[model samples]
Target chain A: MSSEVAVSKTGTRLRSPRHMLADSATLGPFLTLLVLFVLFSLFIPKFLSWRSVSGIVNAATPIGIVTIGVTLLMICGEFDLSVGSLVALGGYVFAMLLLAGAPPALAALLAVALPALFGLLNGLLLVWTGIPSFIVTLGTRSIYRGIVWLFSGGTLIQMLERPAVLALFNGRLDVLNELLPKGANFRTSLIWFLLAVLVFQYLLTRTTFGNHIFAAGGNAQAAAAQGVNVSRVKVISFAFSGALAGLTGILLFSQFRTVRVTTGAGMELSAIAAAVVGGTALNGGVGSIWGALIGVLLISMLRTGVILMDIPFIPADNFEAVVGATIVGAAVLNTWLGQGRAKR
Target chain B: MGRTQDHSEPLVRMEAIVKRFGTITALDGVDFEVEYQQVHALLGDNGAGKSTLIKILTGVYPPTEGRIYFEGRHVRFSSPRDARALGIETVYQDLALVDTMSITRNFFLGREIVRRLGPIPWLDMRAMNERTRSALRDIGIEIRAPHEKVGSLSGGERQSIAIGRAVHFGAKLLILDEPTSALSVAETRKVLSYIENAKARGLSVIFITHNVRHVHMVADAYTILRHGRKVGTYYRGELSERDIADLITGERER
Candidate 1:
C-alpha cells in the first residue's frame, strides 16, 4: 500500500546524547576483560603460551557456540534453561551410537539430529503452550535428563576405538608446513565455532529475520504490528538455542570419550553466565558473540585458575554469588552508562 | 480549524465496528473514515473506546461485528501482521525501539537491507547508515547515525524515528495513537510538522487521541466517540471546539 513516498531530504540525522551510553555497554565488559587479560598475563607468566591459548580456545568451543545461540535468544528476549539437559541427551545418544557400532558420520549426524529434535520439541511446546520459556524449558529439561538417566541407568557410556568420530571431534586441517607460522589452519570444532559466530553475528545484524528477532524481543506488540512473525521467531530462537546446546553435547561426548548424563548437568548455568557476562541481557534484545566468548573464557580461566592456585576455592554456591554479583554489577554499570548517555 | 475533515474519497472506511470484552462492549457499532491524504482525528475520553477503535484498525483487536474496508475492499484482520501486510503501519506512544541497536537497525527492523555476493550476503552497514540518516532527515529529523543506539535519543527524537520509519515505508494508511501526548511543546510541534509532512506526501492518516486541542493543529476530520459509540463525524469547518467539548463530555446529542 506504499504510495511511493520520497525519502527524507533532511540534511542530517540527529542522534541523542543518550545513545552513546547503550553503545558503550558492550565496551565496558570488553575493556574489562582486556584489562584482566593484561593483568593476568603479568601475574601468571604462562598466560600467553600457545598451548594455554589453544586450551582456552578449545574449552571455549562448546560453551561459546551455545552462548552464541543464547545471545540470539537474549536478543529475542528468551532463555533456554533446557540446554544442559539437551546436552546430556545429545551426548548420550552420540555415545550410544558409537557403542552400538554406528559409523562416525552417522553417529555425528544422530548426535546433532536428536538434540535438534529435542530443541524442536522444546520449541513446539513453548509455542503451543504459550507458557513462558523459563517454565517450558524447565519442564523439558527434566524430561530430557530423566530419559537420559532412565535409559542409561545413570552410568556413562564408554566406547572403544572411536577413531573416525574422535578425529572429527579433535581434527585439524593442515597444509602441514607451508601455512604461516603454524602448520594447521584449523581445528574442527574450532572452525565450527568461528562459523557459528560469523553466521550468528550476520543473522543478528544483517538479515530481515534477525531484525524480526530484535523486534520481537524489543516489543512483541510493536513487532507484530510491523508484520513480524513473533511466534515463529520465538519458536526458532528456542529451537536454535536447544540445537546449539545439542552440538555442544556431541563435542562433550567426543572429548570425554564417554557419555554421562552429568556431562551437561551444569554447563547451562555456565553458558547462561557467559551470555550474561558478555552483555546479553537476561531480558534480551542486546548482546554480542565476542562478548559471550570473553565471558566464557573468563569463566573457564577463573575456574581453572582457582584449581591451579590450590586455593580451596569457594563453594559452588559462593561462586554463584560472585556470578550473581557480577550480573548486578554489569546491570548497574549498563544503567549508569545509559543514564550518562541520556545526559549527553 | 480545519483539523478533521478531508473532502476527498475515504482512504479507510470502518462501518459498525463492534468489539466485546467478556460481556462488555468495547466499541459499539462505530463508523469512521479517513480521506485520501487527510488526517482524521479519533477523539474520546478515557474508557470511551478510543484505544479499541485504534486497536481494531491497526489489527491488534479485531472487531466482533463490523467491517474494515480499505480502498473499497472489505478486510478483516486477525493480527497486526494482517494490517501491516495490507500497508497499515502504526507508531505507538512509547515508540518501541531497541536502545542497544543503532538507529538504522531500529528503522529497518523486520525489513532489512542486505549486500550479498552470490549466496553469502552481508548487511550493507554503510548504505543502511546513509539511508537511515537521510530517512530521518527527510522527516525533518537530521542528526544521528544509523548505528546510534535509540535508547540514548531524546523523547522527541525517538518519536521522530518511529514516525520516520512509518513514513519511509510509504504506507498509504498511517495510524498514530497519542503521538504528542507525552512530549514537551517543542517536541509536539516537531511531531506536528512531521504529520503535516506526511499529509503532504498524500498518506491517509488516523490520528487518535483524547486531546481535542491537538486536533485543531493537524487533523482534517473528527470522529468523536463517547461510551464506545460514534457521536458524530464532522468536518473541521463544520464544528467548533466548544461544540465537540460539549458533545464529548455530553452536551450536544445526535
Candidate 2:
C-alpha cells in the first residue's frame, strides 16, 4: 500500500479548488450585496442616509423572519407555498381579535398559532398521502387564501388602531438615538429578525433535532433505517414555517396599521428565491440558516436599489425579473459547485 | 419469555417464516438461525427470499406467518426501531448513511449522546468525536477527521463506519447486506477483516450476500436458501467450494 493514502496527522485535508468553489457558493451573495450597496450609495442621492438603510432593514424583517422557516423546511426537503396566505390570515386574525377587545399578547399568540395549524395540515397531508410537498402546499395556498377572503370579506381590515401593538412590533430602538442621533434609530423588527436568526441557527447547528433534519432531508430511507422519525421532522419544520409567516404578518400589520387582504401575496416565492440564492438546494439536506439570511438581505438590497435608481428601461415592478434571474443563476452556480464536490 | 443461560440455544431462531406481497409469496416456509458470537452467512441466488428473510428477522416487515425467537424469548418486532432497541442492527447495502453529514453525526444519527445542562439537551460533540475516532481506529481504519463529511470517504471506508457504529452501539446481532458487493479487491479484503474483527469482539453476525466467495472466508456457518426454502445448514469445513456453488444454483436437486 502507498504511504500517501494514509491518514494525515493533523486530520485536516488541504483545501482544494472544489472546496473553495463550494465556499464561494455560500459567500458569493455577500459580495453581490456589498457591490449593490456601494453602487446605490454612489449613484442615488440620499441613498446612504440612515432612513434609507433603516427602511431596507425594516422591509427585510418580515420576509427575513418567514425565510428562516422556509430555509429550515427546504433543508428538511419540503416547501410551504401557503406562507403568504398565512401572513395575511395572521394579521387579519390579530386585527379582528384586537377589535373584539382581546389583549395584544393574546391576539398575537392566536395569530401565530392559527397559521401554524395550516402548516401542520400541509405536513400531515404530505405524510399521510405520500404526495410531493410542492403539490400539497400548492393546494394549501388557495385554501388559506380563501380563508383570508372569508375572514376579511375581501376588504382590508383597518378597524383596530391599537398603539400598543405598533409600539411592541414596529417601534424604533430610540435608546440608541442618544449615540449617533440619526444613525442609531433602528427598527424593532430587525431585532426580532436577528433574534429569530440566532435562535434557529442554534437549533439547526447545536442540537440533535437539527442533525436529524439534515439526515432526514438528505436521505430519508437511510434516516428511517437508523430510527429517525422522518415524518415528525417534516411536520415540525412545516409548523415552524407557518408560525414564522404569522409573525411576519403581525410585524407587517403593525408597520402599516392595517391588515390588507393581499398582505403576503407572492412573498412565499420571494422567500424561496432568497433562500435558493443564498445557497439552499431545492432538493433539501444542504443549506444553512445564515446563508438564507444573507439571501434575504441580498434580495431586499437589490429591490431597494432598483426602486431608488432612475433607470428608464427597467420599471419598478420589473424588479421581480432580477430576482427570477438571480434564482436561475444561483442554481446554475450551485450545480457547478456540486459537480466539483462530486469529483472530490 | 424466560431468560435461560442455555449455551446450546441459538441467539436468533425463525421457523416457517412466510411473507406474501399482495399476490406473490416472497418467502414460503423458510427456517433460519444464528448462534451467539458466530458468523452465519445467508447465501442464495436473486429472488431466493434472502432479503425478505433478513427484513422479517430485522423487523423491517412482518412475516405473513412465522415466529421469531431472540435470546430464547419469543419476540415480534413492529418496526426497525423496535429491532434496534433490542440491540439488532442491519447495515444495508447502501450503508444507510447521510453523505452530506459529518462522520460523527452520521455515526450517532438516531442515537445521539447529549449533555443535559439546564433544560435543553445539547449535542455532546466532543464526546461524539472522540468516540467516532476510537471506533474507526478499533476497526483498523484511521479517518482524517471525525468532523469530515462521510461523502468524501471511499466505498469500503463508508461500510466500515456503518459496521463500527453498529458495534459501538452494542449490537448483539449485526446483519450486513452485501457489504463487499460494490468494493474493489483490496476494499473487499478490508471489509472481510471488519467482519472478522466484529466476530472476535463477541458479536453474532448475519452476513447476507449472493456472492458465496466473499462470506466463505470469515463465515463460521453457512445456511443456503433456494426459492424461499432452506436447502440445509453446514459447518465451515463441511462443504467444498463446488458443493456450495451447486447448492446456491439449486443443482443439488438434479
Candidate 3:
C-alpha cells in the first residue's frame, strides 16, 4: 500500500519561485500599488507628503467600502450594477429620516437596511428569473436612481444640523490632526473603510460562509450537488453589496451634509474597476478583498498623480482614461499570472 | 412493510422498480439488490435506464412505482441530501469538487469542521487538514499536503480524494457513476484499486459503467441491464467478459 502512493509531480512544481509568487492573490496588486506610489513620489513634488497621502485615502473611502462588497459578490460570480443608485438611495433615506425628527442611529440603520433590501431584490430577481446579474442590476440601477429622483423632487436635500452621531461616520481625526503637521487631514471615514476591509477580508478567508462563497462562484452546479445552497449564498452576497453601497452613501452625506439624486452617479463602474484592478476575476469564484483594497488605493493614487503631474495633453478631468487603461493592464497581468499557476 | 429480523438481508434491495418520464417509460419493473461488503457492477449501454435507476435510488427523482428496502426496512428518499443522510453517497463522474479550492477544503466542503468564537463559526483549518491527510493515507494515498488545489491533482488522485472523502464521511453504500470512464490505463487501475480498498473497509459499492474490463477488475457480482430491463444478475465466475458484453448489447439471450 505504501508503494502504491505515487508522489505527485505537482508537489515538486509548486515549489518553484514563479508558482510561489503567483499563489498569493494580493501580491500582484500590492506590488503595483508600491510601484505607483514610488513613481508618483519621484515625479510630483508633494506626492509623498502627509497631506497628499491622506487626501488619496480620503478620496478612496466611499468607493473603497463599495468595492469590498462588489469584490465579495464578484467572488460569488455575480455583479451589482445598481450599487451606485443604492448609494444615492441610502443618502436620501438617511437625510429624509433625519429631517423627519428621527434619531440619527435609527436613520442610519434604515438607510443601510433599505439599500440592502434593494440588493436582496436584485439577488431574488437573478435567482428566480435565471437572468444574468449584470442585466438584472443594470435595469434596477436606473429604476433605483429614478426612485431617488422622484423622492427628492430631482433637487438637492442639504442639512445644516451637525449632530454628534454624524461625527461617528466622517468626523475629522482630531488627535491625529494635533499630532501631525498642518494639512494632514484624516477622517473617521478612513477608519470605517479600514474596518469594512478587515471584516470582509476575514469573512472571505476564515468563515464557512466564505468557503461556500468561493465554492458557489467556482462551480455553482458542483456546489449545489454538495448541498451548498448556492442560490442563497449568491443572494446574501448581493445583499451585502447593497448594504455596503448604502453605507458609502452615509459616509458621503455625513461629510458633506448634502444628498442629491446624482450623489453616487457612475460609482458602480469605479467600484467594479477597483475590484478588477485588485485581481478579482469577472467570471467569479476567484478574488481577494485585500487585493480590492490595493486596487482602490492604486486608482485613487493614479487620479492624484495625474492631477499633480498637470500634463497639458492628459488633464485632471481626463484621469478616467488613465484609470481605464490601468484596469485593462491589471486584468491582463492577472490572467497571465493565473495561467502560470494553472499551466503547472 | 415490517422490518426483517434476518441479519443476512441485502444492504439495499429495490423490488419491481418503475420510472416514467411523461409518455416515456425509462425504467420497467427493474429489480436490483446489493449485498453488504461487495462491489456490485451495474453494466449497461447508454439510455438503458442505468442513470434513471441510480437517480431513483439516490432520490434525484421519485419512482413512479416501486419499494426500496435498506437495512431490511422500507425506505424512500425525497432528495439527494436525504440519501446522503442515510450514508448513501453517489460520486458522479465529475466528482462534484471545486477545482480552485484546496484538497482539505474540498474534502470537507459542505460538511466543514468548524469551531465557534463567540457567535461566529470559523473553519478549524488545522483539524480539517490533518484529518484529510490521515483519511487519504488510510486509503493508501499519501498526499504531500492537504492545501494543494484539486485542479493541480491528477485524475487518479482526484478520484482517490473523492472516494476517500465519501468513505471518511461515513458512506456505507457508495454509488460510483463511471468511476473509470475517462482515465488512462494506469489511472483506471488506481481507481479500481480504490474501489477494492472501499470494499475492504466494509462498504457496499454500486459501480455503474459500460466497460466490461473495469467490471472484471473489481466487481464481485454483476447485474446486466438492456432496454430498461434486467438481463440477469450473476456471480463473477458465472459469466466471462465476452458473455457480459453480448448480454449488454442484446446479442445473446439470458
TM-score of every candidate relative to the true structure: 0.87, 0.93, 0.94
- Best by the TM-score measure: 3
lDDT scores of the candidates, listed in order: 0.75, 0.85, 0.89
* Residue B217, model 3: Cα distance from true site in angstroms: 1.0
lDDT of 1: 0.75
Error of 3 at B143 (Å): 1.5
How would the candidate models be sorted by TM-score, starting from the highest? 3, 2, 1
Best by lDDT: 3
Kept native contacts, as fractions per model, are: 0.43, 0.73, 0.60
Q: DockQ for all models, in order?
A: 0.39, 0.65, 0.58
**Which ranking of candidates, highest lDDT first?**
3, 2, 1
Candidate 1 CAPRI assessment class: acceptable
Name every residue pair that clashes in candidate 2.
none
* Weakest lDDT window of 10 consecutive positions for candidate 1 chain B: B1-10
User: Taking the tens digit of each residue's C-alpha lDDT, what string does model 3 give over B133-215?
Assistant: 99988988878779877766777788889899999988989999998988999989988988998888889999999999987
Model 3 docking tier (incorrect/acceptable/medium/high): medium
RMSD of each: 5.6, 3.1, 3.4
Runs in model 1 with CA error above 4 Å? A1-21, A45-48, A171-189, A308-328, A338-344, B1-8, B16-23, B27-29, B61-68, B237-240, B251-254
- Which interface RMSD values do the candidates have, in the order shown? 3.2, 1.6, 2.1
Candidate 1: lDDT of B178?
89
lDDT of 1 at A41: 69
